[model samples]
Target: MARNRTRAPSSTTTTATKTQTVRINGARVKITTKAGKVTTKPALPLEWELQAAQVASLRRLPQYQRQFLLAGDMNASKRGPRAQAQAIATGMTSGEPDLRIYGEYGRLLMIENKVGQGRLSPAQKDRHAALQRLGYTVLVIRATTTTEAAEQAVTAVLEWLAQEKGKAA
Candidate 1:
């Protein structure tokens, strides 16, 4: 005769109570709390963060001026059938790049800024292709899953602009 042997379960279980302490900098009153399970969302949207940085960089350079950014398909809370109809009536479009700059001497730049898990949507891809065919300069900037990548993308674009300036001169 053979008998089966079983071992007892360990003390650790998924239901076990766990807590983490996080300190927020620059807060006047830092209160600590503990809970069984904790969930979190991002402090800011990565795509927007990256785009703002790029826009700020462009602002610092004198050659970049009178830029226009497309904002269709953003702000879902403000989007509905009526709002969409108004957009179409006003000649607004979808999948347009997030950034556009009118540079000195007829030079123009168009950029789609993406960070972390962001990617160009189908409409954006088609817009980019159409813009390219029309001899417009279009660029897509993607960053790895980190803040440094976002910063690097901005720096690289600024550097490219500087190089293009040199070529024109």
Candidate 2:
């Protein structure tokens, strides 16, 4: 059982807004939230939702696959401390990507989706580097424009396809 711990707003923080701007990985990102919504600039939208739509659209394409698995790698939840600890003890490993698209020929694409000026945490950076070292295709993407995020995913898959074809030949 996780502990329900909510910190009261400090003097520097405002109560009107749900999020505060802060720099992470050289990118300005909104921190914390209210009403379950991010209060930030218009540069980036909700990332998870955008990733969902992009994955769905890609799934319909034959190039992606007739049927594929899109696994959402959720890192956090609204659970309390105890539950959070329990989760970590179970399978909630640090630095996992947001989405895992298992493609053909055992190819895997790990996408870390970010919205607004959001950036990766230290653990995320470490994970990304580790995955890259292990010969995995990892992408840290921010969904800003209409098709930028999806386009990135497409490009990654295309590159992977080419690499796989080369291996077969």
Candidate 3:
């Protein structure tokens, strides 16, 4: 009789276990999959919450404003209101705010513009408070304004700055 030459069946499975990981606020987090089972690691520091809030606020901006805000070139004079908005910022940073209006005398004013359903996040409130502590006046405005409202807001901000300038002088 011919000897049986068939190989023994393999014990190991060919399917691979996959994993994904992200670090938030300096803490390591991991996600793993095994046999189609998925799991997530624990949350990191509260900094992630703050970052998420900032990102959420950024997402609220119009696409063009968002682009200019990220590019840090909104302060450059261009064509229309968007260009004028960019031109107002003296120092802009994605980590902080949409615009940083600087007075002629060097005082800083951080402005957050909202188009509709104006709401301020905890992180934004914290930032505004911090700016106030640093002697910078912070203002929040609804961007969907008539030309008159826009003019009034600008005048109010400039007038406040003038008073601040007078005090410093």
Candidate 4:
């Protein structure tokens, strides 16, 4: 009689689809795997993400490196009610734009960053209208992704700079 023999399992490929979620740069992204292939894309970027990207891109330009300011308190609502009340008590105005760029001849351009179905609040609308009335340019950029937001911000800034240059001539 022969002793029982055992055989090792053969290597095989599986094609069932799989998915995973991961955090990248503070954003949750979804990755898909099917038939040994993987695909991934970042989730819709948050307002802060868009703002950060815009600032980073703008600062890359020498002319704008020192001429821009970011109003980071726009998201104060997330800081809890006490902090929010304190901020308001300290003269933190509502509806402030995210970015302020000082151009030639003291001209001002304000940009409000938004992503994925975002809209300005009533306070923001009022503030923007008041700013526009004061001869300040206010732009609202709504994009689907961070890169697009940054590109739009850069393009708007470059156009504003060019227009200012033209007026100076």
lDDT of 4 by residue, 57-102 (tens): 8888877646444444464357788998888899877887888877
Q: Considering every candidate listed, which one attains the maximal lDDT?
A: 4
lDDT per residue as tens, model 1, 16-75: 444433434632232323344455423333566566665565556554443222221242
Top TM-score prediction, candidate number: 4
* Candidate 2 segments exceeding 4 Å error: 1-43, 64-68
Q: Would you list the C-alpha lDDT of every candidate in the order shown?
A: 0.59, 0.73, 0.52, 0.81
Sort by lDDT, best first: what order? 4, 2, 1, 3
Of models 2 and 3, which has the larger TM-score? 2
Scanning candidate 3 in windows of ten residues, the lowest lDDT window is 67-76
What clash count goes with each model?
Answer: 0, 3, 3, 0
TM-score of each: 0.58, 0.64, 0.39, 0.70
> Clashes in model 4: which pairs?
none
Name the 10 consecutive residues with the lowest summed lDDT in model 1: 68-77
Deviating ranges (above 4 Å) for candidate 3: 1-95, 146-149
Off by more than 4 A, model 1: 1-44, 62-78, 144-150
Which candidate would rank higher by TM-score, 1 or 3? 1
